[model samples]
Target: MAAPLDLDQLQTFVMICDTGSFTRAADEVHRTQSAVSMQMRRLEERIGKSLFEKDGRSNRLTEEGERLLSYARRLLHLNRETLAAFDDRSLEGQIRIGTPDDYADRFLPEIMARFARSNPRVELTVICEPTPGLVEHIKRGNLDLALVTHNDARQSEVVRREPLLWVTSANHATHEREILPMAFGRPNCVWRRSACDVLDRMHRDYRVLFTSFSATVIAAAVLSGLALSVLPECALRPGMRVLGESDGFGLLPDCKIGIMRGHTANSEIVEALARHIAESLDNISVPSAEEAPAFDLAALSAMRGRRHKPANLMPGW
Candidate 1:
């Protein structure tokens, strides 16, 4: 077996990678530059390979260094979790969670509120971002757990998926001419791609009238009829309603929701938090078109009809 590596040295290496400079890493780790250098030297000797490439002014990780970075991050996270568990098995510790913008905006607040009522002593910190970014943060050990869409072939390994629905304004004019416009998320977003694929396969002509990275912005746009977009049932709002049957639109493939753990070694509090989050999400209601406001496509067309506006049309026209 390979010799056991020093956890402190690995921590130093991780700090260096995160901060990208020894001077900064030393400041963060509360060690002098020379002492930090000594730790690295000793670590390198133990590993029998240079972890970083130092040219006059710039510092970069060697290939071995890059490989070690991933392992070191996981190790440090495990170490922290281990210490936290020994300190307290009761769910009264800080839990840092990362969620997608839409999930954070619509569903997380209520679920977290319930959790807070039950565990008043536990501190919760939530970070919101796109699924890809959240996944990266979890992998980097920056978050104890994250809710995100899965990517790649390892898709089913760490993901739970739910059906999505298309929604639009309840009022519309031309049943045949209603060119559905929509506001969507950034390119890397799963919902955006799924919605577009379904429309294309159905031979439905639609246009993306606007795009925004924020979930709130997309919801606002949909309400204003700036465009129609597909979202999960949990996100349906007062003015927003489902457009079809739950399965009317075939399963939008499976947009995976990843539940990642920072470390499994000794993170009882965090594990409890993860379990709560997963259970809460799984229990959320999935509404169908019949359960939602009924749309009168033909009546909607007559109510406030949509007409094709040419590019050169006058501002008020």
Candidate 2:
């Protein structure tokens, strides 16, 4: 009987495909480049097909390799789940987690739900705050783990870089205004700082009409046609429209979301929760420039013409 494929070999293969180079994969797997190459050779020999082909200086996955990628991911995921299920199920401890309101709203629900099922004995305490506050909590050893937005990638294990968007109410002509009115969260918020810095650098005339710690309040302010706000693309709502160059607005800088561990030593439970958060976030797809929708000034103008009266410009706060 033919021998079954080794999980280690499959792991190496997947890493190579993901990293797009044997050298990088070797670094990730803690193996020498030659060792990684030998593993790939043995894997191809067992499968009776070449998994990769040389495309110029880079190696591209073959059709067979492409087919195996999906299976490899599923098999690896299942393997991890099985191992975790058999691990010390009795392990119990408290894990304190911190995150910005935006990320907490988008990702924490599913992450916490899955974690609750897997680690029923583990107690979780989550704190929602701005990125700066979360970072402070982590530094003060008040939090076991934190998810935050930072300009520096070296600050933590970066989960992803999310594009910032200039969002306004779809029903309002706020984008066409000469001096833009904007809403932001707290003064120390990353989004608020980025928005103000970009506007200042661009020499744009803008006014901060509202400041609130609650994302709901900020969203309500935007939806009420009182102001435009800069937000991570994922935080944008269906009723909001993204402004682009055509809308005569300067582009906002992207923000990197990272995972930070508290200064206090992490227990096994804390480490496990951090791993889960990282994996969950890594699985999310960041929108490409081509996929992002641009602002339609013509449409906004057309809608404005049909409006019988101007929108209320008062701050929601």
Please name the candidate that would achieve the greatest lDDT relative to the true structure.
Answer: 2
Query: Distance (Å) between predicted and true CA of 196, model 2?
Result: 2.0
Cα distance off (Å), candidate 2, residue 38 = 7.0
Candidate 2 Cα lDDT to native: 0.75
- Which 10 residues in a row give candidate 2 its minimum summed lDDT? 308-317
Q: What overall lDDT goes with each candidate model?
A: 0.66, 0.75
Q: Estimate each model's TM-score.
A: 0.55, 0.76
Kindly report which residue stretches of model 2 are placed more than 4 angstroms away from their true locations once superposed: 1-9, 17-20, 23-51, 61-75, 286-317
- What digit string (tens of lDDT, one per residue) describes model 1 on residues 176-295? 345767788887777888888887887777778788878888888877766778776556666664454331343355445667677534387676666666656644544444544554
Off by over 4 Å in 1: 1-89, 151-161, 173-179, 245-251, 254-256, 263-266, 287-317
Residue pairs with backbone atoms closer than 3 Å in model 2 (clashes): none
The digit string of per-residue lDDT tens for model 2 on 1-317 reads: 87987899999988876666788788999999889889989989988998887665556777788778767765776577667667786457788999877788778886897677667678989999877788788878899888888666337787766667788988899877889899998887777988899889878899999999778788888888999998775576657777766666666667678888886665788778877787667555433334434444453343334332322121110
CA-only RMSD, every prediction: 18.2, 10.8
lDDT of 1 at 12: 88
